[model samples]
Target: MITSEVIWLTGASTGIGRSLAIKLASCGNTVIASARNQQALEQLAAEYNNIIPLAFDVTRQDSIELMQQQLSNYSGHLDRVIVNAGTCEYLDIDTPDWDMMRRVMTVNYFGAINTVAAAIPLLEASPRPHMIAIVSLATLAPFPRAEAYGSSKAAMQYFFDSLRIDLVSKNIDVTVINPGFVKTPLTDKNNFSMPFLMSSEQAAERMVKAIAARPRQFDFPRRLKWLLKVLGFIRALWNKIIAS
Candidate 1:
């Protein structure tokens, strides 16, 4: 059984983060939910006394600092932080909006870094600090039009992995979550088919379980992981198949 702890979850206004907040709160943990939508977060907070909504844009450094302040209002130390906030933008190779790359990176990569920076001090104060980042399985294999999204997640994966080593002596645990595809507001915008797409609730349940186990990394929907591994192993064939 996972013991209750103070957990801060980003992107909790909807989708996976929201599902995770609900699950974690239901399990008797005090959850600090952060998102850009204040009203939506307030509505969610109304459902549970343990859920405290902190509204802020993850892409903005100033907002991140403000969020850290707001977090202190609830608890002096944070036992866990789930940096689930991120953005995705597919690059249109023919007439690409090059600026989209910067936008995606700002949110998915730099934004996560900012969150980590803000959470580090609070995490160090806790007896058992666990930092979890929600990355993507897209980084496992190259996909069409995924230039921006894939690269951003790849950067995030590396950042967390490296940070894991640095935080080892501090006794802080770092975990990276890679989910294949989930039906959420974010994925709803995708124009292509997403294989083995699971619901936000399903993904959240898996993530919560993984957090309890506290592994270095966790990837959901094993089939997708294997598929990506196979494609990665045969890059030439994959390139030909996609090109065909």
Candidate 2:
């Protein structure tokens, strides 16, 4: 029942963001999809009249501000802003590339912050403003070669948590979605095992439902969340279990 909501979403070229755009549009919300790939965004917008294509690179602060201005031209307020644009790159300890870490952090952390900054004014104009970020379950536990990716997501988790408290009195809800492996472009590149991997559509559905509840944190797949929680408590034991 997300009727009449003017929703702005980033990273909508593919993966979870694209799936979410479709789902939100189908649910009767006015969805503005943003991504660097204009063709992909246009294709998505073609699928539904409610979907508006907005092309911009989230990593660029000026790009985000321009996007906000464009959005303002179309709609006066944004009920929800989903900063789902993120990049994941595993760190190779052998190579120890600081540039790789910087690349990931710039897109996953700084990109999200920039989007939030740009959208805050539009969100404030809404009667019930909500901000959602698609973080990662990797933050819940340490995983090999995920040094950069995990750390970036962890930073996003903390940022959103702090934002939630600060925006509480303003009646602007902030939610962090910690998804386990989902069958998206991001996970498709992973060579390692991704247990309990769900389809992007399934993930989107879960996100839509969870967002309706307006929970501060939405960790999907109960089994996976429980497993991660238990493993987080005893890292050594979990390492042994995974190793064996």
In candidate 1, what are the lDDT values of residues 1-244, reduced to their tens digit? 4457999988899999999999999999999998889999999999999999888687888766777787888999999999999877788788989999999999889989888988888898999999999998888889888898899999999999999999999999999999999999989998777899999999999999999999999998999999888998899998887666
Give the range of the ten consecutive residues with the poorest summed lDDT in model 1. 62-71
True lDDT of residue 229, candidate 1:
87
TM-score, model 2 to reference = 0.96
- Assess each prediction's global lDDT (C-alpha) against the native: 0.91, 0.91
List model 2 lDDT by residue over 17-83, tens digit each. Answer: 9999999999999999998999999999998999999887888977766777899998999999999
Give the residue spans of candidate 1 off by over 4 A. Answer: none
Clashes of each: 0, 0
Top TM-score prediction, candidate number: 1
Query: What TM-score would every model get versus the actual structure?
Result: 0.97, 0.96
Native-to-model Cα distance after best TM-score fit, residue 87 in candidate 1, in Å: 1.2
